[model samples]
Target chain A: MELTLHVWRQKNGQDSGKMVTYKARDVAPESSFLEMLDQVNEDLIKQNDEPIAFDHDCREGICGSCSMMINGKAHGGRKGTTTCQLHMRSFKDGEQIYIEPWRAKAFPVVKDLVVDRGAFDRIISSGGFVSVNTGGVPDANAILISKQSADTAMDAAECIGCGACVAACKNASSMLFVAAKVSQFANLPQGQPERMQRVSNMVEQMDKEGFGNCTNYFECEAACPKQISVGFIANMNRDYLKASLLHQEPVGKA
Target chain B: MSWIVRLQKSSLGSKYIMAITGAGLFVFLIGHIAGNLLLYFGQEAMNAYALSLHHLPYGLLWVARGGLLVFALAHVFIAYRLSFHNRAARPQRYQYEATLQASFASRTMPYTGTLVLLFILFHLAQFTFHLVAYNGPYTDSLGRDDVYTMVVNAFQNPVYSVLYIISMLVIGFHLSHGLSSMWQSLGLNHQKYNLLFRKLSPLAGWVLCLAAASIPLAVLVGVIK
Candidate 1:
C-alpha cells in the first residue's frame, strides 16, 4: 500500500524542525514499521539525499532503542506494542501519518524521531543498583523469594526505559520509569542495604534532572510497550517520601 | 513555589489539607445532590427544604456556610499551587505533542476545572442573589417558609436544566480521575486497595455524574409535571 508520511526533520540539535511530507509507493502490508522505514531510507539513499535517522537496534523489540511517535498515539495506536513491533498493516492506503520524536524536557530530540533517553540512565545510576556484593551470587535458595514475589519484581523490571511514560504523561513525568527501577532493586533482599540511600538519591536526581512529579494520570501505563503498571510509581512515592522524611540524603547522588 | 512542593513533601499538613478539603468538597457534592433532588419533590416540598436551612441556629448556620467557603477556596488554592509546580517542572507546551499517554479524564483536567470554576461563580450569583434572581425566603402553601421551591422554579426552564446537566457531566469526568487520583498523589494507595481504587474510581465518577445530572434530566422531562 502506498502512503504519505509527514516526518519531522532537523539538521541538528539546534535546528528547528518541521513536518516535511514524503511518499512511498508499493509498500508491503506485512512489513514492520521500521522495515517500511528502511525501504524509505533506501529510496532516499538512491536519490543521494540524507536518509532519515531514527533509533533502532536488535529490531526484535527488546532493546527499547526504537522510539517514535506515530500518528497521534505513541507506538501507532497499538496496545502493549513497541514501534518496531508495529506493522504497516495498521495503516491504510492514502493515509497521512504524523511521525515525530518523543517530546519532553528530559528526553530532548537528538535528530528526527530520535531522542536522548540518557536521563533514564542517569536516574538509574542515581540509586537504581544494588551495591552490596551479596557474596558473589549465593545459593539460589539463600534469600528464597517466593514465586509471587519474583513475578511481581519481574513485572516491575519489565520496564524497557523507553521514555514512553514521559511522552504519554501530561506532566512529562518519569516517575514510572524511576519507580520501576527502584522497586525492582528494593523488592529483593539483595538490594536491602542501599535501599534508603538508593531511593533518596534516585528521587532527588529525578527532580534535579527536571522530570515532573507523578500526578497519577496513569497514562504512562497505557502507553508502555511492556504494559508496566503505574502502581510502581506509588511504591516509589512511598519510598521517596519516607526517605525525604527520614532526612536521608543519598551518598552524593550515588 | 518550590517551598510549597517541598512542604507538601515534608509532612501531612499540606497534603492533608488538600485531601481533607478535597473530601469536604466531596461531602458538599453529596449535600448538593441531596438538595437538588428536592426539585422532584414539587414546589411546596422544595420550598420548605430551602427555608429550613435558614431557620437553623445562627451559630450552626454561619458555621456551615463558613466551612463550605473554606473548603471551596482551599481546594482552588491547592489546585493552583499544584498546577504551578507542575508547570515549573515541565518545558513549554508544543502545539503538536504526545504524552506517556493518559486517560481522557486525565488529559482534560485543567480545562474541565476551568469550566467548573466559571459555572460555580454563575451558579452562586443566580441562586444566592435575591434582587437579581432569588427573592426573599420562600414559603410553602401551609405558611411554612421554604427555599427549595425557588430551586424547583429555577429549574422549570429547559435551558437551565440542560446547562446544569452538562456541568454535572464535566464534574463526573473530573471526579472520575480527581477523587482516587488525589489519594494516589498523596501516597495513600497500597496493595489491598490499589485495584479497588482504580476500579471503584470510575464507578464513583459515574455515580456522581448520573446522580448530579439526573436532577436536571428529571426536571427537564417534566417528571414533576
Candidate 2:
C-alpha cells in the first residue's frame, strides 16, 4: 500500500512548526503506524536530512510514551488502542494522514511529534502515592478487599498517564487522568490514611499545572487508549468536594 | 488556600457552583412553566395566579426574585470564566478537527447559553419591567398589573412571537446539555444510570422548549385571545 503523510516538523521547542507532506510507497499493511513512520524517517536519513522526531518505547502500547494525533483524532481514532499498536491496515491504500503532537498548555511540543509531558509527573508527585512505611510487603490476603472494590480499583488503575485525554478534550482538561489516579487509591483500604490529603493536593496541583476543567464532553473517554470511563471523574469530584468542605488539619507540625 | 477562594478559583470548585446554581435555576424554570400553563385554562385563572404571586404574605415574592437573580448571575459568570479558561488551555487549533462522541447540543453549549441569556433579558424587559411597549393596557378587571393581557399582546406581534420561538428553541439546546451535565458535575452519576441521563437530557430540553413555545405560538395562531 502507498500513503500520503502530512507530518508536523519543528526543529526545537522555540521553533514554530508546519505540516510537511511525504509519500510512503510499498508500505506493508501489517506494519504498525510507528513502523510506517520509521520507514519514512529511514528514507529521510538517506538523503542527509533530519528525521522526524517522535516518542516511542515499548511499541506494545503500555509505555504511554507514543503520543500523536492522527487526522485530528487521538491515538489514530481507534477504540482502546495506543498509537504504537495502530496498524497501517486501518488506513486505505491512498489515504492522507495528518500527524501532530498533543496540544495543551501543560504539554508543550518539544519537537516534531514530540511533546514534554512533565506536567503529568509533577501532578502525580504532588499526591498520587501512599506514604505508609510497611517494612516488608504484607500478606496479600490480609487486606480482605471486596471483589467489587478490587475490580473498580483495577479499572481505574488501567490509566497509562498518556496525555491523549488532554489532547482530545476540547478544553484540554486532564480530569480523566487525575481522576483515574485518585480513584485507584481512593478505593483501597491501604489508601485510606492519606485519602483526603491525596485528593486535595492532586487537584490543587492539577489546577496549578494550567489544565482546563471538565465539562462532561466525553471526548477524553472516547480518545482514551485504555477506554477509561469518565465516571471516575465524578468520584474524584466527590472526593475533592468532601476534602475541601470537611477538611481538618492533620495533628502534626504546621 | 481558603475553601471559599478555592471554590471561586479552582476549576472543579467553580463547576460545583455552576451545578448548584444551574439546578436552582432549573427548579425556577419548572415552577415558571407550570404557572404559565394556567394561560390555557382562561384569563381569570391566569390573572388570579399572577395576583397571588404579587400578594404573597411575607415579601416572599421579592425573596424568590432575589434568589433567582443571584442564581442567574452566578451561573452566567462561572460559565463565562470556564469558557475563557477552556479556550486558553489549548492555545493552538487543530488543523482538522473531528468529534467522536459529543452531540451537537454538547458542542454548541456556550453559543446557545449566551443566546439564552440575551433572551432572558429581553423576556424580563417585555414582561416584568414593562420596559417594552405593546398596544394594550396593563390593567385587568381587579385593577392589577394585567400580566395575562400584557403576555398575549406581546405574543400577538409577529416579530415578537418569532423571536420568542427562536429563543425558546435555543434554550432547549442549552438545557439539552446543561441538565444532565448538572447531574454529572454534582456527582449524582452512576454507571447504571448514566445512559438514562444522556437520553433524558434532550427529552427534557425539548419538552421545556415546546411548552414555552406553545404560548406564543397559540397567540400567533389566534388559538388564545
Candidate No. with top DockQ: 2
Q: Tens digits of per-residue lDDT for model 1 on A1-254?
A: 99998888877788888888899878999999999889999999999988889999988868888887787566775899999999999889888888877777788788888888888989888888876555586676878887877887899899888887777776777878887898887788777788878877787777777776566778788888888877777676677666656754346854
Badly placed stretches (over 4 Å) of model 1 are A25-30, A92-95, A133-140, A213-217, A241-254, B1-20, B36-67, B81-103, B129-132, B137-145, B186-196, B214-225
lDDT of 2 at B224: 89
Compared with the true structure, model 2 gives a TM-score of 0.97
Error in Å for residue A21 of model 1: 1.7
List per-model TM-scores for chain B.
Answer: 0.82, 0.95
Of candidate 1 chain A, the 10-residue stretch with the lowest lDDT total is A245-254
Q: Estimate each model's TM-score.
A: 0.82, 0.97
lDDT of 2 at B63: 98
What is the DockQ of the complex in model 2?
A: 0.80
Give the number of colliding residue pairs in candidate 2. 0
Clashing pairs in 2: none
Clashes of each: 15, 0
**Ten-residue stretch with the least lDDT total in model 2 chain B:** B128-137
